[model samples]
Target: MTETALSFELPANLAVEKFIAKLSKKTVIELALQQYSLKTFYDSFDWRLYNANLICEFNQSKNGSSLSLISSLNGKVITSTELDDVPAFASEFKDNVMANKLAMLLEVRALLPLTTVDLQIYKINILNREQKTVARLMIEQYDQLKTRLSIQAIKGYDKAYIRLSALLQDEFSLKTAEKGLLIRALKRQGRKPNDYSSKLNLKLTPEMTAAEAVRVIYKTLLKTIKLNEQGTIEDIDSEFLHDFRVAVRKTRSALSQIKAIFPDEHNAYYKEYFAWLGTITGLTRDMDVYLLSFDDYKASLPESMREDLNPLHEFLLFKQAHAQKELANHLKSKKYLTTLHDWELYLKRFIEKEDLQKNTHISIKELADSRIWKVYQQVLNDGAAINEDSPAELLHDLRKTCKKLRYLMEFFQSLYPPEKIKTLIKALKGFQEVLGNFQDYEVQEISLKQFSEEMMQQGTPSNTFLAMGVLVQGLEERRGKARHDFTGRFNDFKVPLNQKVFKFLFAHKSKGE
Candidate 1:
């Protein structure tokens, strides 16, 4: 049997008795009431499930509690499980198809309770001449205020469903619901989906001055940093510290790369403070990365020896707790608080009466073109000079240069054609990935060696050190492989077509243009 359902918003003025009285004139109807139930909605902090058009809800009724995954588009149940409680992570759920799908989407992220609503349902039956049910209608009131009406079609009763729909629309003047209950409830609470992201999405124009554009970028970055600070202090997840560090790094890069937009002394003062901020937050974040990657480290060893790494995991966790405490203390210190306050106050001072830098009054387009072209050439020069015989420092330097270029392009992407800038960024990404992998593997091996020493000093097990040795060997091999792939990736990045596109999009323009 085919199934179709339609939902409409009930106007506030419509009384339940009056509506039932109006409906009885058109068809034979019977109304039944059910006790109110509570439904708690869940989603990731970033709304990963809701953004994908899926909803996870746990319903609590007199009978029992059940967890369900439903489609937001048609309001149909996709999968469900009868459970007494919801788990923090998807892997804790019973092993089944639904659990597997949830695990794939929510890797390393915890499920958070979004909101709860009281739902009271009224089930109405549309009867035929013989008193058999032909179609089903429901009036649902949420939190004792918001109401919705839904019509469900029974088998071989499509005509009844259509007739009921027309009567509700033509006579009652009820309009279709434009948004789902989750969205409407969130709106009422002054919250929104997809509100927080680490990406840079600035709306810049060519005519704005360089100083004005820089201020705009700085303000956005500052806001992102402040928003993530409490989460980082609480150690909610690794992503909080990861995003916080990214904002700090981006701020430092912008200050150094965007020359002549601010006074030299002012730039130096903030640069020093931000560098200190980066240092204090470094150890705990490093430990977070190591813990997050522990499974991969174990997988690199022989299956028989993988369990031997458990002791090393314990050692790392012990150190992480210490590092976390240190980091939290620093974040709560007066120095950290004062530095951010001073930075914001400095940014707010727009006194045009003060001294101006050389490039402060220039068009933003002019500054973006000149700075981006300069860095793009440096990337080409650095990549071309590296070879099999070159030192690792050269590759590391190239990686930092590539990062600066990527940030510059992102900051001023609005000045260039969207497609062209995106193409260049995409091509550059491949090159950056290889370099990043090479460096990551190298750093992991070195840190593991240091960790092994610390473990020995702390009287860790011998088998754990043996397991780490094997892991280091595997990482070295992978790093070598990534280093070998670097040349081909660089070659693809500097191909004639890519070079032509880069030049056309960002080449410096003459004054008259």
Candidate 2:
């Protein structure tokens, strides 16, 4: 079904019947026109878009005020291609779809016109029939990045609402759904399986448990996307970069929350992915934050400084673009495809079919840790296997390991004292920072070189490019120093790691301050 949600009311000046008649027939529409009293906590008609899943919404009252939020259709929970056509439809109905009825309180039969068909995942309950063909929202387990987390307690809608809300919290199940898409991605890419995801699913073939399936789905991200750091998009077109940033943010958020749900032993795998995603996404994100904090930082500057700022922006943009391309390449690789496919197969196998019903209460850490650690050790070995020409790939793998460790510690941190875990966390943070700085600088340097060349070719002014060169020089030097320091610090890790410091910290962690 199309993932678009459109809700519009007729203007008070205009006839409600006329507006409803005009807008009721979408390319494929299902209508629920019913009066909804505002929740007591929200006395006003505070209607917000549910999630990123919202395509476009426009409302008009008989009065002359309206509201609308533009949307996109990436990773929409509802699998409908019609959603791709929503923007055009929105563009078509822009004028009459919204009402100018400006009332803080709206208490008519609020129409909810949706464009989707797959309603099996949704079960609506019939409270007193309000003549609305649509069932009252019994369950809502959806969240868009823009959507606020909320709880609604209707007198009779509690069961479905609670069930769906609970299901949404179990991300393991969501990831399994995503894993299906990943499988499609893999077949689209032409790759074979690594046997990890499928094997795990096979073990769970008896009956399906959304809870149990979650663990396996998480393991896939730990194995696949966690290997590379995120890519930035500042250097691209503004619109492209904006969407790119959003995608990166969502992916990182997904990775973080998914890892957070697993038992302690399995936590290591997620930690590594989180670490890597943070490292890669940091440079451009820092720039974005800087821009957000000091809007005039780049535009208001002395001549020399302006020159430097121009180049710096150029350099950062280049790095961002390069990072995105790198990530894209990584995602398209055989290794990634294998992981993605295997993950989906497992999801379909385990989640769709409940296997472990009898002994479902055991901690999954034992299973996750033993399995992931074995793979992680092999990753360390595989990284070492790369020749000098492939130092980058090797380094990527190393960062992956660190990410796994970070994921592990973070998940298990609940079991340990903050103080005990502090030292180890600090070190992990440092290691991630060092490599991150190096990567950003490398990208910056390359971009500067490109800008300088392009300027020479175009015979543009030199001051900005020259200033950028100077900036890169400073960053490059710092990066060199950081790398050297990181190597030394990497060696330093031997001390605590030898004593099983992380494990010890986790084992003895305090529950409270």
Candidate 3:
């Protein structure tokens, strides 16, 4: 059924019963109350649904459970499906319109429970002189104190809706509700949507000491680590572990690249710890990447050969689960806990010290300019050195250099002209994309071969082995293309416009500056 509804927030002090009693004086009012428990809001880790102005909720009562996908923009139920049970993953949804839509929106990501809320729904019918329903009102009281009022006009009753809206506004002081009840409740609990992201948002100043700047960066990374810890342990999604690994890598990069910012011994010690962290997570993340690409891998083969690939998929799944368990155990270990605690304490202690090391006293702008310029030139030289005849390892090494340069650019982006830095970063990213794909394809080829051996040992069928060979060939073709594209990508990055911007930002700085 198609209907238009307007949502508003009722003042906290207003009671639904009292409001209905007051409305009874103007017209006949009918009320129905619904108590919903185990009401959950679902979204991707990134809040894709909320960002798209969509609300997806699962409600369970004594009778059964229902899933509702509503469009917040129009307050309409886009689709509703009654399920025997709520599936943990979107792919597990039965064949239905709602499930299809959700699968498209959340392809590989699990639908994480953002928040749970208990709703007290009061459905009201406003009638006219003939006792015919003219309009409908839904007042949803969340737990207590918070209420959302929705007024929907019955078809052919626009005048009634206008009259009722005016009466509610004039008498009760209704205001347009900009946020959903789930969001409001989350706010009341001091949490908000999109509260975490993998990107760096730390604010660094030119006058801040190197120790303080390093502290700020590490603090942000530490928080990211902590934020993803629960999700990683629960195996909610691969991204949690992926993001955790990235944070650790960034922390390591900061320590090694931004030399002398912290004490030598501390930097060395934490670098080792972070290296351990990265190693422990490596197998799991690698398996996650392979498994996540399973669909594409299957499609790479002919239809006749696709069914044979199921065994490979099972093998990958088995390996992923095993690796994930190990990673979780490592995360929960005493050694891991002690490392994080010591690192945090180190940051706090060093940042508060009034005395500055020699390098820490320098202005961040000068330091950034010097280091970025050095890395930028290094990338150019390295990229220029590579040719069609160059070994694949050369390209791999150059990719690593590009990563360091990219991280430097991101860390000190605020110190330069905004547009200039943005343009340079964009160009660098395009170059890195080619290098990254090239490396990934290479890694995938090696991994598939390794898995084939393991599968054989485990008595995998010969058909599965043949399917894996086809997959390996497919990866090689992609890798070759990426290798071929490197020249064009490098040239694009080294174009005069980007070169000028990079030079203007980082080239003029000196050691003594």
- Which number leads on lDDT? 1
lDDT digits (tens) for residues 186-214 of candidate 2:
34446322322211121332133325634
A best-first ranking of the candidates according to their TM-score comes to 3, 1, 2
395-431 per-residue lDDT for model 3 (tens digits): 9999999999998888888777788898888889999
Q: Give the least accurate 10-residue stretch of model 3, judged by summed lDDT.
A: 30-39
Poorest 10 consecutive residues of model 2 by lDDT?
A: 37-46
**1 or 3, which is superior by lDDT?**
1
- Candidate 2 vs candidate 3: which has greater TM-score? 3
Candidate 2's C-alpha runs over 4 A off are: 1-305, 311-349, 355-363, 371-397, 411-423, 454-459, 503-513
Residue-level lDDT of model 1, residues 1-513, one tens digit each, is 435479898898887667888999989998855556788888876677887789998888887888888888878777889888888788788948767878888776667788788887778889999998888888878864468888888888889999999999999999987777777777877887777776888878999998888888888899889988987888866777888899999999999999887789989989988898899989888888899899998888999999999988898899889998998899899999998998897888843544488888998888888788888999999999999989999999999999999999999998889999999999998899999999999998999999999889988879898999999999999999999999999999999999998888778472432
- The model with the greatest TM-score is 3
Stretches > 4 Å off in candidate 1: 1-4, 17-33, 125-133, 351-355, 510-513
Whole-model Cα lDDT of every candidate shown, in order: 0.86, 0.40, 0.85
lDDT of 3 at 161: 92
